[model samples]
Target: MAGYLTTHVLDTARGCPAQGIQIALYRVSGNSHKKIATAETNADGRTDAPILPEGKFAVGTYELIFFCGDYLRATGQTADDPLFLDQVPIRFGVSDGAAHYHVPLLLSPYGYSTYRGS
Candidate 1:
């Protein structure tokens, strides 16, 4: 079996896990995004488990939708006019599963960053 795709979101401005943030995993279909799974972050700012398990991992393109608007609002960190990028989408590819692929997002109300983690 191959590995899976997962992500953790951190509210960089608040310096904490982005708890209760809405998240969605989607696979890009022809012209639209196909929703696969929807979940929320826990107290630790991570999904309760791997977003996708070993047997479920696939070698293709994937996108993670993070609802920063709700996260910031819930955490009392929303900007004056909110952020233009309320929904941050990170599109990436999963080529191999033998290794663990952890993607972490460090985000703020106005900007965010993502990288391949352990």
Candidate 2:
């Protein structure tokens, strides 16, 4: 089977899925960054479809930027003028074109974490 890219965001501080967070996917080559896909998390904290679907799968470095600032303010999780953690970017590589890639974000008002999830 061919591979694709998927992701989700969980609001750790609120103990629930982070809805309406905007996410952008980009292909990174040296000093060049090209945006390839974008989506907003739904009520389930996930995009309705794969950010990078199978036909567009590639083997190289990529970045997923999670726009969390608005979500924080909407959910009343932040009161600072500028949040310590706002736009979270996770950079990773896909060496295999035939494997699934799941990058999930566990987030809070002050911190965030990610992993190669299934």
Candidate 3:
């Protein structure tokens, strides 16, 4: 199969898809970083298209930054003080360009978790 990158966010606090959450994709090399794309989560907490489309998939390190603080506030679940979990960044490597990479995040106001999904 051709390779591609995808992601989804779930609002663990609200038990629903985290709509309107901002996300950015970055290519990381050593201490340098280059942003490749930016998108917002749809009603299903997913981007309308693949983050790294088929032909664009490559073997390298990348990061996905999720704006959790803004998301929490938009959903009316923010605290008076600073949020412990503001931006959630996930970094991972791609070794094969012929496989699918699904990174899904389970997010809350103070905590979040992510995993490789099918």
The model with the greatest TM-score is 2
Overall local distance difference test of candidate 3: 0.91
Question: Which 10-residue window in model 2 sums to the lowest lDDT?
Answer: 77-86
| lDDT by residue for model 2 (1-118), tens | 9999999999999899999999999999999999999999999999999999999998999999999999999999889987888899999999999899999999999999999998
Q: Residue 104 deviation, candidate 2, in Å?
A: 0.5
| Candidate 1 residue spans exceeding 4 A from truth | none
- Residue-wise C-alpha lDDT for candidate 3, range 1-118, written one tens digit per residue: 7899999999998999999888999999999999998889999999999988998889999999998888888778887468888899999999988999999889988788999898
Give lDDT tens digits, candidate 1, residues 1-118. Answer: 4687778898888888888888889988567888888888899999998887788777778899888786677667765674666888898887886657788889987789999998
Please report how far candidate 3 places residue 18 from its true position, in Å.
0.3
1 against 3, candidate with superior TM-score: 3
**RMSD per prediction, one decimal?**
1.6, 0.5, 1.0
Assess the local accuracy of residue 17 in candidate 2 as a C-alpha lDDT between 0 and 100: 98
Winning model by lDDT:
2
- Give the poorly placed runs of model 2, Cα more than 4 Å off: none
TM-score of 3: 0.95
